[model samples]
Target: MITVERLTKRYGPFTAVDDVSFEVKPGLVTGFLGPNGAGKTTAMRVMAGLTPATSGRATVLGKPYAALPNPGRHVGLLLDASAQHAGRTGREVLTLGAILMGVGKHRVDEMVELVGLTEKEANRRVRNYSLGMRQRLGIAHALLGDPEVLILDEPANGLDPAGIRWMRDLLRGYANEGGTVLLSSHLLNEIERVADEIIVIGHGKIVAQGTKDELLAGAGTYTRSTDDEALMAALAEASIVAQRTPTGGLQVEAEPIAVGRVALAHQIVLTELRGADSRGLEEMFLDLTAGAAREEVAA
Candidate 1:
């Protein structure tokens, strides 16, 4: 487990991250989501002990990351795609990292293959690698030590659909085996698909944090299709808020069951009665981030 308790960071007059706090549990994929400049990278850097927080703390398995015995053996972090040495081949790079962490060369090859980078590509210079290949190489380095916790920032940035699916499955398996996974991404659809929980931040503060269901439950959008005039009459009588769309449909803001019951009494023929929260998560994220952005602009 990884715990972030009021983790804060500042640079001169600007606060990069402010009192950011969340916990990542084992056996679950926790997504770290936010807009650009929302301080996710700063927080992740602090958690990895690559950068110090100005106040508060981030702990890996109940101890400060730096204070852990062979911290590299307990936490694997891949922060950026451009972090590797250009002159070294992917294999050589991971081999050196493993050697420093007391991992053998055999283990290095295993991780490279696990990340889907063939031995031939691993033998090529990192500078010669494509963006996707380099991203995989970064993941390979992170897995070299077989750490219990993984922290990756935009690990899916350069991956194709197949590679992204492979990564999702790999991380899911890793968590299933009792590992902790923290991932940061801008891809909401992908995050919705893979994350068991999400921590959404904007302007250095958490705006939403919970399982997807919990977030959806708080929203007031649903889809209902029925005889239009009867549905309108029922909505008008109940004073329940609803709107007719340009596409000859009505979007309702009340409970689906309530809508259905009212429609039944009014003899409304139903064609579709599904919830329509297409941008539920997107709207939630924007609502949080946009407020912060406006505040920043005002300041």
Candidate 2:
């Protein structure tokens, strides 16, 4: 399990992570999400001991990262896929990591294959690898130690649909085997599909964190009608808050029945009206991040 309690990080007067606290339980894939500057990366860095926390704590399996023996074997991290040496082959990178960790070359081959990199591909210098291949190489290096916990940032940044599916299944299997996985990514749809729990950060603080179902429960509807103005008027008269979405639809903060009634009363022709079938993560993320950005600007 990974525990973060009131973790904070700052650079001079600028706060990057502000009193963030959350737990990544064992046997779960936790998706970490936020906007461009939401401090998600900072918080993960603190947990991985890549960045020092100004205050509070981040621990894995009840101990801080620095205190763990052979930290690589306890926690696997893949923060940047492109940070490896360009001159070295993918297999060379993993082999060196394994050697330093006292692991044999056999494990290197195992990880290379596990991450879907064929021996031929792994033999090429990393400089020649595409972003997707780099990502795969990074995954191989991360799993080389067979760690019980994983902390990854944008691990699927350049993966194609099939590659993403492969990674999703791999992480799911790891979590099923009683491992803890915490990954930050901008891919909301992927996160929705794979994560057992989600943590949403905004600015420098956590605004929402919960299981997808818990967070999306009773989420409002996406409603639209042929007579947009009439529908809006009806909903407004009924004191139901409805906002126009960019795709020329109404996002109603009420159930389908309420929207249907409004449309019926106004004699409006309904084109679309649906419950919270969508992941709802995108909506919540935009709201949290927008609000935080506004606050930051105001500050």
Candidate 3:
């Protein structure tokens, strides 16, 4: 498991991460989300011991990351795919990582194939590989030691649609097999599909954090009836507040059953009834981080 407690990071006069706290539990994939300059990368860097937190702590498996023996064997991290030496081959990078982690050289081959890089691609120099291929190589290097935890930043940045699907499946399978994954990406849809829990950050602070269901549940129920005005009046009478959505649906403050009961009692014919979150993660993300985007633009 990964635990970050009241973590804060600052450079000069600017705070990049601010009193952030969250956990990435074992056997679960946690999505770390935020707009640009929101400190997602800074928080992850603290967790990996790449940057010292100005205050508080981040730990992996009950110990600070730097204190762990053969850290790569326990915590797989791929912060930057392009950080690899340009002079080395993809295979050479993994070989070096394996040696550092005290893993067998055979593990290198396994990871290379596991990440879908053919033998020829693996042998090519890092400078010659495309962005997508570099991402694959970076994933292989991270998994080379068979770590129990994976911390990746924008691992899908250069992937095609098929490659993204493959990555989604791979992370799901890894989590299913008891690995903990903390994934940071701009791909909100993929995170919705793969992550069990989500953490949203804005202005270096945690704006939201919870299981996918819990966060989305607050969006409330959405219902549309043949006679929305009549249904709205009925809901008010039942002490259930509701508002008309821009799409001509009722966004209720109550559960689906409560809304349905009100409609049924009023003899209203319901055409649609579901959680408002059915609009999907992208909508919810936009709602939650609405001002953050404007702030980024202004900065």
Candidate 4:
């Protein structure tokens, strides 16, 4: 539903986004991820037509976002939850959005309830709402238009555990209903749970993009054992990537079955045998960026 080609953004002499290209398909949650200054937000903004890119182009459904007819109805965005007026009530805020989008008031009310804000709370002023409440209000505004595409930046920010789960279900539901979702976040674990595909960026360039299985297929190996000393010896024998842990176990970059076979052959009893596989999205993200950092230092 969204495509970016050789997209880049430059500031003065520095490039914030560099030759980035990717696609966000319909019926899937594409997790857009990167480090703190990796230009993820910039890229999303550019795609949304909120900011202009220095080079290349981005489009939704084969048309530039700005050129889309009634863009508010084609793209739902939740970039900054704090942009709401402190004096306006949640209901009024949504009402205003509905007016601008030419949507009915029913949508506004329905969204308020859908986001779990009751009538009394929705009628309360924005300044009185907690950060989590404001975040929900932001979501309500985004859904007011019921766009075909969603571009959310840190939608889970300031949300409680329950709210975070709710956000996950909400996004997944949108994708299941055939809507395209492109959301940005630095939290790899959170994204891992809901994202069908991942786009990893570092230093403003795409480091990797693929399904979870595809990423792990090329990722380095890992092994775990309760006896660190014995595990190290086993890893050394196999010449596999290995490390010792303080817990007296070995963490090796080898398949779990391989480790187990070696353990059995050597008559070594292991309390745990698992692939030193990437723990979660967070670990995969760290591994990619850390490698990038090392290359930078060497250069």
Winner by lDDT between candidate 2 and candidate 1: 2
lDDT comparison, 2 vs 4, better candidate? 2
What are the per-residue Cα lDDT tens digits for candidate 1 across 1-299? 99999988888878878898899999999998877677888888888888888999999999988988987798888999777889999988898899899988899878987888887999999999998998899888888888999999989988999988988999999999999999998667777777888888887888889886776655554555557777877888998888887777787776678778878888888787766663567887777666645332211
- How many residue pairs clash in each candidate at the backbone level? 0, 0, 0, 6
Write one digit per residue (lDDT tens) for candidate 4, span 169-244: 9998999999999988777766776688989888789988998666655443454545556767766887766676
Error of 2 at 29 (Å): 0.7
The deviation in Å at residue 254 for candidate 2 is 5.4
lDDT of 1: 0.83
The models' CA-based lDDT, in order, is 0.83, 0.85, 0.86, 0.81
Over 4 Å off, model 2 = 221-274, 277-280, 288-299
Best-first order by lDDT: 3, 2, 1, 4
lDDT of 4 at 36: 65
Q: Model 4: runs farther than 4 Å from truth?
A: 216-228, 264-267, 275-299
